[model samples]
Target chain A: MTEASVRRVESLGASELLALYEQMCLIRRTEQAAHDLFMSGMVKGTTHLAAGHEAIAVGASAALRPDDYVFATYRGHHHAIARGATPEECLAELMSKATGLCRGKGGSMHLTKASTGMLGSYAIVGSHLPMATGAAWSARLRKTEQVAVAFFGDGATNIGAFHEALNLAAVWRLPVLFVCENNFYMEYTPIAEVTAVPNPAADRAAAHGLPGIVIDGNDVAEVHDTVARAAAQARSGDGPTVIEARTYRHFGHSRTDPAKYRPADEVERWMARDPLSVARQRLESLGVSADELQQADAHAAGVVEAAVDAAKNAPEADPAEAFTDVWADGGSTWRT
Target chain B: MADVITYRDAVADGIAREMRRDPSVVCIGEDIGAAGGVFKTTVGLLDEFGPERVRDTPISEQAIVGAAMGAAMTGVRPIAEIMFSDFLACCWDYLANEIPKVRYMTGGQVTVPLVIRTANGGGLGFGAQHSQAVENWAFAVPGLKIAAPSTPADVVGLMAAAVRSDDPVVFFEHKGLFASKGEPAPPDHVLEFGQAGIVREGTDVTVVALASTVATALAAADRLAEKDISAEVIDLRCLIPLDVRTVLTSLERTSRLVVVEENPYQGGWGGTLVSIVADEGFDLLDAPVKRIAGACVPLPFADALEDRVIPTADAIVDQIRTLVAY
Candidate 1:
């Protein structure tokens, strides 16, 4: 999908467009810092950065309420930030500090903050699909007008949980939106190389009786509009819908890989359509001043700097926390 | 009031009572509604409560558990049944990941008050595919609570308790105990979690058992008595929230421990019990903790092979003899 074919969902004023650009820039700067820390051995463990895929997170998160639940894959830094988590809390989690969202136990892959309705992010491939469906189902049963959105890669469409969750959501008419960020590659393998089905991952939803849509992922406006419609459909109890966003991950799958599987030319082609630049241009065309855009960029850089400082200063996790949250109070008597 | 009832009836009655007490309580499983469950534990639940409450689902273990997690999170207390414990492997992601971690992941924004009841253990000649005890799998999961009851009274109490819990609980019912008859204690009798029930009290050695092993332990305790050895038998009501205190207390008096379980020896709950005793109560132990677990072999389809794979009273008595002599 080309950027020219992408249609803006909602026309944002100059201020709103600038805010969106700033948010996307903030995600990029924060994740870039993480990549540097990971390279320097300061931050440990595998991190699936959201640097290349900030537009989807920023645009989609803008369409939902804070009370609605959101589930994401391992690549979830942007999702947490866009869902209103402070960059400090998210960075602290990546740094394995005590004040992290999971109290340092979950690290990068399992970071979660239920207070902000970021239900949780899972490292397991398609595991959280059913979980989001269950949460959405719960909301409907309780008469809550909340919706559940699960963000996964194209690779997840082949997993059993994806199919099961979609079918269950359709049969029960549950309030769920399955967003497939078809980033072209499952780690080293491309979706076209792995998936036998010719259509987009969203097309698979039609078999489950839910409407499906394909959109240009690099276009923030398109992602925002498509997800807004899907979220609305879910909140209205119109069952589930699948939105396939054709995007790309510029970096390697994990910290270790440099994405040798993709040709350099393809990566360069995707970099030209960088999501943050597109959002910035949209705002500029709508009469936003160059000074205003620069101010947003500087402020976003400041947020990133503050987050890094806070994460570095955060305390270490107490060894005793290994025993907590296993169950509710009086839930288990296994001694420390 | 005391009444004679089968283990299945006692459990069914517990479900009926809980449904009547809570308007949001519901049941979902295969053949549970119109078919009344394969073993008839829910024989008339659909008739007593409408299909809305006692629901029969398709033969999808993943869906059964996933939907129950969804329903429970929304305020409905769901009692989901997997036809056999062996089938648990198919839907393990839902049980181990989603159901248990939902509340913690949601930061207490929601609660998964769900119960997954499945029959386990061998003796029905159902073979390896249908007759494996998978309670150990549940024991490994963090946020999941596991319980296995031996007597009709404990069955009723524990089933009710499992539903009342806000955490995800995996309740394992022994297939062999379904026909075992016992006196039903009062319907209001509630057996708390992490508390062991001393079925037969003695002082020579403490025999720690759970589920079907309780009966074998009792029989072994009787045999030990004839041999002039007093044996204290304690039934572990809940496995995960294990009654470590009861075991410690029993060992303080009895001075020896023997854990009998239906699962294989390696990575089994019995191993966990032994580790606990060795780690915490080493100074008080008169002898090493002995474990009489199922043979480390795939449960055979043949009756003779299956019998050999499971622990019997003879196996328990033999292990106790070794522990006592030591």
Candidate 2:
């Protein structure tokens, strides 16, 4: 927490601050709408909502270029939307329609749009960290100044792949930014209970010879400033940085869990500093009028409503697609 | 012209051939850089391709495979070595759950065009942990393309095809066959998948094998020929794009099938061959289909005990005699 750099909010232009606030509003609206769709029985299975973690995706992605790659976890709607995947397609993927991000093949958990540099949203925990390293290495080999970002939860830091990926990235001096969204809980259990260290990601960054960074994930300006500096270091070939964003998940782990484990006061305390509220206050202090903030919320709501309609109108994916895309030849046949 | 070379040298030649042809081709593994790999299969790769193209990795199988998968998705063709075939279990998640399923999950947005080559099977008393033949482990995964070459020539040929394929390929090179000599594959050699080579053609029994068992089956055929029992040996070059047509055709004339494999009996890859034959060519069988597989037990350390567990040339000969008698 002490090590990460954060500048005052006055440095960001009024237009840029408004854009970041709009992005966070967009994610908040999208995940909430997804929650409604699931409760209405329109979206099946389960959804991992990112209600309070909006600023991390929005602020972090704002610092990355379009060519830079992002590997996010299953609860990655915010990351996908931030990286330019249309809300219509991401919602379509949730509704299992033909027009989805993964064309309905990867429902709820997996959402991939390589065209947008949203490499994928992997459901399996702690798996894609090394993948990000590989992409960064490839960028270096091609002489491109591209960097790769991997977004995971606090639980992933304890996994073997996490250590291996960090060590390899450090040893190779790869342009990788490992962002761990530490929301205090890994599913139902408190991450603090299972984790050996107090700060899972930042505390161990020194072992890999990387900077130990912890930031106020709810503050959009702080997140933006820290990630931008980390990205700059990476692009300049100074190697990776580990950032732990201390936030809280407003919703339960999934659609099924009610998350009754938290004390009422603890929940209330975190909700008081909700990312949307924090960003709104930041906008107000930066001279954004109250009317403009209302207009941003209105814009977010309108886009989500239109996206829902467009996705609902799209037909179900064809059964033939199930057999296709299993191989490069567009066929699953492995034998004669 | 390097007229004759061992199977291990051919492995290096295959990777070098591809690396020379495509700049995107890169090789990485433990001790593969300057030490030339534990089995010396990757010797001369580092000196020839430089440290960038032929790089060494830490003892992290997941990172090696995962990095290769990511590199492939981002346009670099990578070839990762697992050192031993049994060590694939360490990174089974990347191979079974990640690399193979990427294209399908992303709806063809990515192509994991990578090769994972490892030293496979037992003959030199490496014992249980290092000696187990686990190609069957990868064979069960649907999206992977499996290749187990029995000779130096097939090594070069299959390595070319695996590196060029748009899908992920798991290549198994026999540790026992490293020293076996054969004519070197030409520089331009590129064999396709699904084409099984007829090592020795005959008219009695169809003996089908892959990698280590291919040599054992060939030796059995020679002994069977002495006893007036002609055996046709079919070398299945690639497992995923399996040439069952070749096996069915061979069985068409022979009317009897015997599957020889180094994997254990309970869930070996031979079961797939037997099932397909029973389903498609059941009427072509004159006797019950026989499976000469490695004993369902850990490979022992002693030479005699190890010989009992792994399928040997004499074991293949004895089995073929019993099947011929039936």
Candidate 3:
């Protein structure tokens, strides 16, 4: 990391640091509960958890305004939670309950809460990049200062839509932020096996004629400070910025994956740099007491427990509701 | 209040009218600006809407459709052009998987008012890569509304309706019909999606066709008059909202059905139309339905081979005569 960037990270106040730590804790706790639910067979289907990469979601989303839009990938529970989606609503949607966001139509991978500006989450890798770019174009046409953020993985940067979206955004000077959370692995394959470059941000941004910033994603202060600057630049009509956060995922790609492909030493190393623990250490060094940190952890645990309870009790979605929402005209007589 | 205009101008006029009517309407495609598009359908859109609204994009169909889908969800009506229908294969994932399922997947929380305009069909000698009648591929997708307008008037009306539609509309303009001139549609004319236009009403046999095939069917109807066959030609403006009522009504009078399409015979849209009739209006039929379509092979570049592959007016007339004889 550059000395200048490190100095900027140190500029964050104590309360902001505490808030970042609290959000990271909440995400870690919620994802653990989700993993437990999946293992217990309470949650059907596969889920990609973002336990080790919480700081990127929490920090980058904290930089945007409440009205600004966020387009996230399938591993998106953290993105939604960081953007102010209630834990109960997110868990219920994962559980396929009617009261959940998207009314249970989109479960786990496709969580959407328009009220919080968390536009739909996509499962297809790098596909949502163009949509996010389009959203930025819409903002430009409407003359709004709103910035659109696309949260994708390192794997997505290699996809055709990623390059196309970035090129379009750069050419049109659209207000969009491309955030690639480099989780070191694309499912089970190491990124180096597929991608030619060690870091995609600088080369890609240079190709598109935009500023590219890379930071230690495990550091919440660095992630927040860098994203906030990029968001401000986008809002000021300086076109898009590519931000690559170097991070890792503690769990396997999905519920069924055991991540045996990963080396044991590599897992230990990433686990040591866990974003939650990293933030907690930062808070401790900033004169926060251990008791206060423990209390915050307990609070996050309580929130996750309550969310799980609510999701378990929520009613199953109605079978007839499937026919609805297929068309906006509601003239579809296929059901009738 | 109607003037004569080419099919290209009719498409341009429809898009320009929608842009002027709604401020949120924007056009995004390759060479659609100063170059006026490959087919010149977006000839004057760049000057009228400026670059902000009429955007010339890179050769990226996935991004173009994805951007339009994203913009549509955010209250901006985007009319994205894919240059050629064959190029849709490059971004079929976005069209088949993403764009069509957004509204339904979101439980109607968001509506994609997106129009994907592309030139389809063969006959221009653009070869296999350029010329293709692949509307059937898009027709198979559930949520998409597919439109294939035959004349300038129908093109204008369908284009306007597609722009105003809340669902994703795939507007297919035939390459062979671009130069064809016809009466312009009225300023406020927006053809309802599920309604079919009966170009020539008759009683012996009902010939259901779409886009360029509609012209072929109309010519066949005229030749059938000489033979006293009295063929009915139904111009299916859009395929998604298949106008079964009109086809069924025509079938009630004419018990024989002959479906024609520019695509191949196997798994083509003609098959779907034939299946619908066979399943629902079986008792009304006097004979087995005949489907006249392109040969089941890649469209060759040679004119003689292409002519042999595509169904001509004479073929349609012969098919009708056989169905009428039955």
Candidate 4:
């Protein structure tokens, strides 16, 4: 491995490190199970999994306070899991159960838990960035120290909302962290083909007059440390920060995509550096026993399985729920 | 005591009253701060509330509306201005998809108490880019509420209602009506949605209008009276929660309908009103509903051509005469 791939361990305790490992493992196992369920025709609609991008979600979420808000993209199961959404709720949403996060109104692409500060996951690319910035603006106006983190892919950086939100956040000096998960591909097209700049964080941040940092997203510790620092700066009223986390997605853009556009060698190269494995190996090198790591893995697997089983048994949402929640006044005449 | 105030001042007064009543209320838009907005509707707001509440945003409509959505979700009532209704095309996704869908999509986890105020209607000679009325675009969104106030009193009353609504509201202020003077609205007056204002009472033909066309309909009513044909005029204050009851009541009296609007006839809010009347009050109609609307074309810059494209008082009079004869 190159020297850049070797991430230095931070000041986290053994238990904290184990917890991070468990979170990442839980996300992976849950996503894998969700993919299997989709393939078996049990789960309806579509799902965008974050198999390889677990570290960014886990680490960034680990750095945020319980009340800090997180806005994520369609590839957001990991984000929901890391932000304290139980696998049951996440899978229940995918399973279209009434007990789901959005009460099954929002399927896989719109899992949200306001209690955990996991704002709704957006299916439209780069659409939620402004909302995140607006949340930060609200926090500032309310004299609260809450910070909002917007998680999007590399492709979102090219969208107009992305540029507008960044510029507004900077001008208003709102407490927001713009996290870009650079997985190299925006849907099927490679980022290099669409993006005008080499580093999105650097290019976009310069234009908006905000601090930009490109870090190793595969390194959970690095992501945690960088996000922790940025979140601190935001809470202290230093304005927003743009963080470009360089990572990869192990799965296709969606369930049906075989990712035939990607070369076999490139996929193999990234798979070899899987974030979970890298973290596991680092934990082992730090004197963690293999049995302890195995126990964590088993725990994660059990949790995911239990969630799937529970989701399968959860009651279907009432059809009348479609008419509700459309308006606050309870006067929506929309017939189901 | 009611004072004579311009529609622009009425809108500003309504915003100031709301801001004073609620500390969480804020205004964000381009040139709304030190420059007092391109239309000067937001003048003296920066001085009253300071910059923290009155923000001067960059020319970013998507971010402006999106940020307002976020703020509204988090307990702040944001009044964002798009300068011109035509510019809503620039941020259609946020206004159409994100802003309107959030409350419903989140299953009522959040409420977007946002009021997007934009200047609409033609006759200003700003051409297609700045003069086109796009209230129909907002009317099409189910979750969105639309308010188009014609007189100064209605402007303040509707603005208050919009700021106080839990749902997202799109307030279309006609640029032509901004300079027009009317009696000031009562203090703390808040008009409810789906309430129609009867500007003129008649029994020959009922004329439905909104925004700038309300005045035209009234003028046409006066001309129709000279011809011994009295026309009843109804100003539809809000479009989404349409006041069909009032229109139906007028239809029962008049037995004839003529819908007038500044927007094009195809897919216009006037068509929706006509549809409602047709679907519900078909027995009351003495004749088929006639629509007097702008021509289906981009508004041109030239004065004579622009005059032909938009509906005039004469056009409303002619439509009313035809319906009355029928």
User: Which sections of candidate 4 miss by over 4 Å?
Assistant: A1-9, A334-336
lDDT of 3 at A171: 89
Q: Given the true complex, what DockQ would model 3 score?
A: 0.64
Interface RMSD of each: 3.3, 0.9, 1.9, 2.6
Clash totals for all candidate models? 0, 0, 0, 0
* Candidate 4 residue pairs in backbone clash: none
* Per-residue C-alpha lDDT of model 2 across residues A1-336, encoded as one tens digit per residue: 454354444456778989989888888999989999999998988899999999999999888898999999999888999999888988999998999988888877888889888899888788999999999988988788999999999989989999999999999999999999999998988998998888899988999888878888898887888889899999999999999998999899999688999889989999999998998888888799999999998999999999999999999988899999877899998776
**lDDT per residue as tens, model 1, A195-222:** 8874456668778888777787877877
lDDT of 3 by residue, A8-102 (tens): 55757878888778888889988998898889887788899988889998888888898899999999999989998888888888788888877
Q: Second chain of candidate 2: TM-score? A: 0.98
- For model 4, residues B1-326, the per-residue Cα lDDT tens digits are 55699998888888998999999999999999999888889988999999999998899999999899888988899999999999999989888888878767767777889999999989989988999988889988888988999988899899999999998999999999989999999888999887888999999988989999999898888888999998899998888778888999998998999888888888888887788788889999889999888899999999999999999998887777777777
CA lDDT, candidate 1, residue A132: 80
User: Individual DockQ of the candidates?
Assistant: 0.40, 0.80, 0.64, 0.60
Reference-based TM-score of each model: 0.92, 0.98, 0.97, 0.97
Which 10 residues in a row give candidate 4 chain A its minimum summed lDDT?
A1-10
TM-score of chain A of each: 0.95, 0.97, 0.95, 0.95
Candidate 3 overall lDDT versus native: 0.88
Native contacts recovered, in order, as a fraction for each? 0.30, 0.71, 0.62, 0.65
Model 3, residue A98: distance off in Å is: 1.1
